[model samples]
Target chain A: MSVLTSSSEAEGEAIVLASLVEGTAPAADDLEALHRRLELAADRDRMLDLAYTTVDSPVGSLLLAATEKGLLRVAFAVEDHDRVLDVLAATVSGRILRAPRRLDRVAFELDEYFARGRRSFDVALDLSLSSGFRQVVQRHLPLIAYGHTETYKQVAEVVGNPRAVRAVGSACATNPLPIVVPCHRVLRTDGGLGGYIGGLEAKTALLALEGVGAR
Target chain B: MNTKKPFEKVVAEHGPTVLRVCRAVLGEHDADDAWSETFLAAMRAYPELPADANVQAWLVTIAHRKAIDVTRLRLRAAVPVGDVPERASTLGVPGALDHELQDALGGLPDKQRRAVALHYLGGLAYAEVAELLGGTADASRRAAADGMRALRLAYAIPERTGAGK
Candidate 1:
């Protein structure tokens, strides 16, 4: 029996194994069809509440996620897309699917903003990720206007708490919706660029993209 | 906390592998049903799965369950007493080779067949295969070896003869 199980026999087994996998594999189109069917099924069952897709921008790939409530999270590629999804899966329903149709309006707005065709985003905002004073600060960001700057102190005062300057900074730093919320426009009292969750480069790029000069 | 991705990414990464496992276990005709059921069941349970869980192994385990379900359903349907239908031919390149290999795989006993499919096609280790099949790891290994030996005799001989011509 050992004589029959030589190197040639091992090679033969490998060949057979290869043939077996290759032969019975389902077609690529079939898998795609299945995915579409599953997507519809999940949607009908109301299980896929969070839908997301990646959109190319001047900075890099941006992960745009949405729920029926509205556009929820926009993450930079530098933040690690996988980690972002994990957080969404944990905090939000893990019923997330990459159905780009739900993000069509958001993608279009982002594209328009990057192309300098739009000054303000009209997309619906979902602030479920933010709460308390942080939520108050986020709601005030859009009032700063495009191509303009607001000191954290100014934002703190706008939300009716000038003493909450540091809180304003923290809220902007953790802003779940960056570009859409216009958090990059928040600056230091000394006219400094301050911090942005998408990294300083993206902050500078978004500022410059809006013609803010980011100085 | 463990990180989890959207089910779309999961399907893109592992759909083909799962399909192969299903086909290896249930053959072509019923593999589609098994594959669909596996993913549907997986999607339902994906959210509750621990973040750090091994996704491929998890998927293969689901495929194993789905394959068993398919087999049971097929057994029930097969009791009609009419002549059994022929295995449908696959399309495209290597169709003939695939047909021969499918025939060779179809000739094995159930345990040996599953051992070879899970270990060789599904890329599971003998220990994992044993865990899925409820046998000792050693038993799974022996079954795979025996199955492969039989497959070589059944599948490789024709190729060798054709090449020699």
Candidate 2:
């Protein structure tokens, strides 16, 4: 959570945060029934117009964050129920509402992606962050495909600058799209795994899944 | 310029945790895609994350959705994941239990399942889960304990590597 210097802003944020974490929110039993799920993250009044999602994903229970603009955040290893809600309120000034229909649609699409090596998603994206070089990085990231590894130099080459290896790495390091762009597929010229923005292990795992060379 | 905010820092720091969660919930092959998707989803909107939000819980929610979504879709389109066992299936559980453990875990209500898996697999404290998930500490405890109880009842056969080994 950002350090709130303004007591009023802090107080308002706190109230919004408190409202988000007001109660006991749990996922529904039916894996497919995300819409019926109501999380006790906040009071009924607080989640008035927010997008509510409790997705049964590969990673434990995932709580998706979205607004009319599109998905805002995706949390993992959900702990500290109150803190989570507070963070959400702080992110978007408007009250956090739990509209299941809005989030469930994203959940359904994500389900398809995981059920296999999903090459595409039907969910509309906000893509607000991918601009300039970041957009360039995202555009080239996915072209690496599954199981193929390219050195930073190679990525630079693909980006049309064979000499800009380090720059390419930086672009990749800050890549907005990790999977759609397959950043894990990027590697060093040697067989060694390159540094991953997430971690080498995750990078290795992604490569392995695509049957990339694993030593 | 420390342009990246706390939520972004949270994503960078806890990327593995998110990936691990996805793997545990989704499966190996699909976990990476889900993990990437989770972050991609986060990037698009994390810039505007509420100042006081529980970053971890937000990520967990994403991981959970992406993992389940991809896994379910695979179940629909690919050969059923079924009961095929692999050497690593024991995961660090020491006990060589069958997929029944996962099946029982899968059977749990979402909150309970998350509590158990986070505490057990992810090695998170109940308090941590509570804060991220925005639940009372006691509530997190119950969900985790209840999940364990259900697994015990469902499996009945001791840890396949059975008893303190």
Q: Which candidate is the best by TM-score?
A: 1
Candidate 2 residues lying further than 4 Å off, grouped into runs, are: A1-63, A67-100, B1-165
Worst 10 residues of 1 chain B by lDDT: B87-96
Kindly list the per-residue Cα lDDT of model 1 for residues B1-165, writing each as its tens digit. 644777777888998898888777777767777878887788888878898888888899899998888776766666555664442222122332266767777777778888998988788999999998887999999999999888878864443322321
Give lDDT tens digits, candidate 2, residues A148-191.
66788777777777888877777777653344446667777876
Residue-wise C-alpha lDDT for candidate 2, range B1-165, written one tens digit per residue: 112343333543566566556545543345556766676566555546665666666777777667656755655565546663221221223221224444554566767766765665555678877875567989998887776666555655333221232
Worst 10 residues of 2 chain A by lDDT: A23-32
Candidate 2: what lDDT?
0.54
The weakest ten consecutive residues by lDDT in model 1 chain A span A1-10
Taking the tens digit of each residue's C-alpha lDDT, what string does model 1 give over A1-215?
Answer: 45444655666877777777777666777777777776667766677778888999898999999888899999999889888987887778777888787799989989999999999989888999999999999998988889999899999988999899999999999899989999999999998888888888998988888788645
Best by DockQ: 1
TM-score of each: 0.79, 0.38
| DockQ values of all predictions | 0.38, 0.01
